[model samples]
Target: MQSPPLIIGTRGSPLALYQANLVQRLICEVSGRTEQEVIIKVLQTTGDQIKGELKYFGGKGLFTRELELALLDGRIDVAVHSMKDVPTVGHEDLVIRAILPRADVRDAFISVKYDSIDALPEGALIGSASLRRRAQLSVLRPDLTFCLLRGNVGTRLRKLEDGVCDATMLACAGLRRLEQENRITQAVEVDMMLPAPAQGAIGVEVKRDREDLTEILAPLNDRATEWAITAERAFLRALDGNCRTPIAALATLDGDVLTLRGEILAKDGSLRVAQTVSGQVSKTLDAYDLGFKMGEAVRDEVGGRITFDD
Candidate 1:
């Protein structure tokens, strides 16, 4: 009898499929497995079925719960996820086996009439599904009106073309992955709009007891990206971050030094707190500590003013 083909589970979105296929190719090359022996299993997640904003619908887990349940049940060998959509806390029975190399960690401004965010007229309506983006943009342009926009990349683009909103924001990484970079009117700088924690990274999750699968996927992990994501996620975890909270964080590693920048905003974007912390750290735990401390500091600064009440 032959072993079953290695199944890689992922959401059915175009970008998700692209990432899954990329992982499939990399795994095949590294493991010397024939493409026939490896396959992708598309799974529909709760986030996909919802038409409204994600913040109101329980946030990040909606994107990964079904696939995770499949993993726990041994329905799939591994699951690929967009790290940004993953919650800071994870299922105890699973582990992120690998972290793919990072992609562009900046947000892209897309608009048909305006050339850039700055060029938009006052009171320009902006559409975004991310509370962080809406809050950050509100801080920059208080006069702008925001409406909920939710869908896959192509759907969002189509909505933009149909003038569903004057302008919108998307991850530059997704656009580049989908080969739709031309749609980006402006690649907003990180300083202008800090990215969500773990944005632009792909994570592969497997059952904690799957040592063989872990070793097989080990080669795909990038240490630097892992360090950065570790810190950012730790920061988010420390703050108990969720879709309801407009939180943004980015971590960068340079040699032995790691730096983490974080921002938290009021729901209405009326108040904001931002901070940066850096330290000499060579280990993942050290990176995590650095990020967690920063999150705690920021949370303390904000006190009880910010509320998550819907």
Candidate 2:
């Protein structure tokens, strides 16, 4: 009997399609399946419909729920997601079965006129939809202002050229995937701006009961990326963050050691709290308890003045 085709679901954006296609290529390579064996399904998401700021329409899960529903309904065998957009908590019946190797975790500075963030004159306006980016940029250039710029990679770049703001910020990974890296003015250093938790990773989700499919996709799982994402997401989970929340975390693994850094900034970027933790890798690394502890430590230091929703 012939093996059944594997249907992969993803949002219809160019970057999303690129990620899904990457998974398709990898799956075919690993399973020795033909391109015809893996099918890509383009699904619409609530996040894609909202015309204004994302915070208004429920942020974190909006981009992922439709594709997830497709998985739950058995309409697709696997769902590929930008891990950063996935909620910190899991769906009842679905689990992340694999993660592609990580890409650059740094934010990229993009502009048509200005060459870099620092080169922009004081009081320059920056365009972005992420509270995390806004808060972090505020720390570096408080004099700068921000306006909302929502949509896919192509849309944002067009808006930038049309003068939506003096410049904009985007993830380097997204640009690279979209083959728009040439448009980046500079790749912001990590110390200058720590990335959102799991910023540059892609996660593959499947129904919890699909052990067969899980095994087939297992080879694509990068152990280092998995360890780092587990830790970083733990930090987000502990902080109870959504996209509206100004929270950032990044984790790195070197040999048997894992190091994680997390940050929470007030929406206006006036107040911030940051923390870091390092540990030897073990079975417990997968548990991500260290990241949870780190998040709690920062939360305690910041107190109740934060308005995570706005």
Worst 10 residues of 1 by lDDT: 51-60
Q: Pick the candidate with the highest TM-score.
A: 1
| Candidate number achieving the greatest lDDT relative to the actual structure | 1
Q: After superposing candidate 2, which stretches have Cα over 4 Å from the reference? A: 284-287
lDDT of 1: 0.93
Q: CA lDDT, every prediction?
A: 0.93, 0.91
Looking at model 2, which ten-residue stretch has the lowest summed lDDT?
278-287
- In candidate 1, clashing pairs total 0
